[model samples]
Target: MRALLRHALTEQGFAVEQADDGVSALEWLEGNDVDVVITDINMPRLDGFGLIERLRAGGRHRDRPILVLTTESSDEKKARARSAGATGWIVKPFDAEKLSAAVRRVAH
Candidate 1:
């Protein structure tokens, strides 16, 4: 999934970064400046919700846009993500065009 997303986003002319888990993702962010972030809900170590919450609590990436891309599609999960400060949500098996558009919209 990560590889697919990376390929799709890269084809859209965006430089993509990937991490296998939320812990590693957070670690990468510590030394990088990114325009936006797209994450899944069920990552190992921390999970997307926890990552968003942690980023929100931190000073650096608080306003950074985070989009959740996962197979999990439920009203409850969406609301939870919103409350945790996710900028947007996209279900898995995503459309490349829509994904690119969402990234473009939030990256600003």
Candidate 2:
């Protein structure tokens, strides 16, 4: 999934970085700043919800746009993510154009 997203975004002229899990993503964010973030709901070390919460709690990335790309499609989860400060959501098996458009919209 990461590979696909990176490829698609790269093709659209956006530089992309990927992490294996939420822990790695947070570690990368500690030293790097990005215009947007795309994460999955389920991962090891820390789930996406926890990641979003941690990012929201921090001063630096509180307003950073995080786009959730997951298979889960529960309204409850969506509400939780919204409460945690996610900028947008996209279900898996996504369209490349839609993903790119969402990224562009949120990044702006």
Candidate 3:
């Protein structure tokens, strides 16, 4: 999944950084600043929802756009992610063009 996402974004000229899970993502974020964030709902250690919450709670990335990409498409989950500060959602297997477009839109 990660490799696929990397290909999709990179093909469109976007540089991407990946993390195994939310914990690693957060750790990477502590020292790096990105235009946007792409995350999955389900992962080991802190989940996407928790990651979004933590980012929202912080001063540095409070306004950062976060896009959720996962297989889950339930409205309940969408609402939960929205409430947690997700900027948008995309269900996998995602279309490369749309994913890139979404990233472009949110990144600015």
Candidate 4:
């Protein structure tokens, strides 16, 4: 899924970086300047909710848009994500077009 999203982003003329888990994502943020973040809820080593919390607490990405891409579609989960500071949500099984659109919406 990550590879596919990376490819799509690159194809659209955006430079892309890959992180396998939330831990590495946070670590990467320490040394990188990212325009936006798109994460899944069920990731290993921290999960998307925890990542959002950490990012918000760090103060660097507090106002940066975060787009949550996950299979969890319950309203409760969506509310929780929004409370955790997610700017948008895209359910899984999405196509390349949808991915690009979501990225453009949040990253811009």
Locate the minimum summed-lDDT window of 10 residues in model 4: 56-65
lDDT of 1 by residue, 50-80 (tens): 9999999986798999999999999999999
Distance from true position, residue 58, model 2, in Å? 1.4
RMSD of each: 0.7, 0.8, 0.7, 1.1
Better of 1 and 4 by TM-score: 1
Colliding pairs, model 1: none
- What lDDT does the true structure give each of the candidates? 0.93, 0.92, 0.93, 0.87
What would you estimate as the lDDT of candidate 2? 0.92
List TM-scores for all candidates, in order: 0.97, 0.96, 0.97, 0.92
Candidate 2 global TM-score: 0.96
Error of 4 at 43 (Å): 1.0
**Candidate 2's residue-wise lDDT over 19-105, tens digit each?**
999999999998899999899999999999999999999867888999999999999999999888898989889899999999999
- Reference-based lDDT, residue 75, model 4: 99
**Candidate 3 local lDDT, 1-108, one digit each (tens):** 789889878989998999999999999998999999999999999999999999999868889999999999999999999999999989888999999988889887
Q: How much is 21 displaced in model 4, in angstroms?
A: 0.7
Error of 4 at 9 (Å): 1.5
